[model samples]
Target: MLSGFSSHWHYLWLVAASLIAGVMNAMAGGGSFLSFPAMLSMGILPVQANATNTVALWPGQLTSLAALKSDLRKDLLPVAALASILGGLTGAEVLLRTRQVTFLHLIPWLLLMGAVIFGISGPVSRWLRARSAEPHAKRTPRYFPLFCALFPVCFYIGYFGAGGGFLIMTVLALFGVDEMHALNAMKIVTACLSNLVAIITFIVRGAVLWHYCLISMVFAALGGYIGARYARRMNPDVLRRIVVLTGCVISAYFFWRQY
Candidate 1:
């Protein structure tokens, strides 16, 4: 255990951080960028930070899932759960096999692309909004196919989770899922799979700091709960814009620094 009152202070900081992470995660997926860095700066070892962050994410996921329990009933829950399990396992396996060095090379390009896509999200949403009065039946075939194609997005979420929310939102929209439900369900399930699988894998590899993970998880859960509660009151369009802008800035930084 951490000595003195510093441990409690750490917990408090983590709680606040988790709250921010939860909000960002519920609204987008790049919340890790914040939480991970915070942990690193707090003197957590690199591997420990990663494992702890993943573990902490669990609370947030559970919170989000609980909030959406009603809508996630019937066939949806089972299928989504199955998908998360399978996809998360695959992603963890891939992460294990791959070297972080490879990602270093790709980060720049990925960020640039993310920025471009974010820049266009507003116009895309506007176009869709204009068509709100039209029968969406005609667009089903084209859109559904595009959405299904994004199943691989889960793999990436499991691997990194940098901007998985943006990808999910974009893909879900293409498939014609309503914005709010998709955001809620996607955040919860994705977090479940990504965090659980990664935590298991990292633990087996001896990559975790159990004390830190426990502390972070506790706070992150609190954050996620508060975030979900807050999201319930916000406008999707407004939240989306904020997420997009933030994503663009992150992507730009990656592009310039890594590329």
Candidate 2:
């Protein structure tokens, strides 16, 4: 649908980008930072870029779901999906009602903070893991705070998802969900819900680039499938480092350019 690139060349890039995006999304959460920028650089405008990126990411979620259907904890999915969907809807309404230029100015700083928080997550998690073996009763108050904590984060994802994966990972960690496969599963489901709402809102506003979305979804799906299949094979810690570094660089680039 996107003219200029030959079918063969475009498909290659599509698969490459989607693969990168799927792996990044599963491992960290900022896959959009990669896919969105790539789209923009290829000539799509901001609004269209956002819409197309949301649609593109759906496939990644689907792929992840298919790959991890067995390992998924069904109990958490309903609540996470509800929270993400409701928050996303609210975010879309707020975005529709407000001016976004102010938020754009704030994105880099927010992403930088997210990156820093994510970077220390490993160490903090290690420390927490050290303080082990508490009674189940004692842990309730310790971990229960995280469900309510997602308010601002999921709302932001619905509004703008740049560093959302980082936020999701952080929230999951807080809630005592530490396994990468489980976390990835949660991310995929929650993201799917969030993006579904955002995509609908964007479509109503006529913001989506259908051609770009169509092409990108195919690649993103494939990438997500591959990542899901091989998720257990890679070192999750290394993947986390790569994602954090990417977020830091992207945040810095935007901060320098805009500020």
The best candidate by lDDT is 2
- Could you tell me the lDDT of residue 155 within candidate 1? 66
Question: What TM-scores do the predictions have?
Answer: 0.65, 0.72
* Deviating ranges (above 4 Å) for candidate 2: 1-16, 66-82, 96-107, 124-148, 162-188
lDDT of 1 by residue, 18-107 (tens): 667777766544566556655654677544565567767756666556767665324344444555566666766676666556655554
Clashing pairs in 1: 19-223
- Report the poorest 10 consecutive residues by lDDT, candidate 1: 138-147
Tens digits of per-residue lDDT, candidate 2, 29-87, equal 56765776566555665545656677778656665567766766566765676678778
lDDT of each: 0.60, 0.67
Alpha-carbon RMSD, each predicted model: 5.3, 4.7
| Best model number under TM-score | 2
Candidate 2 clash figure, as a count: 1
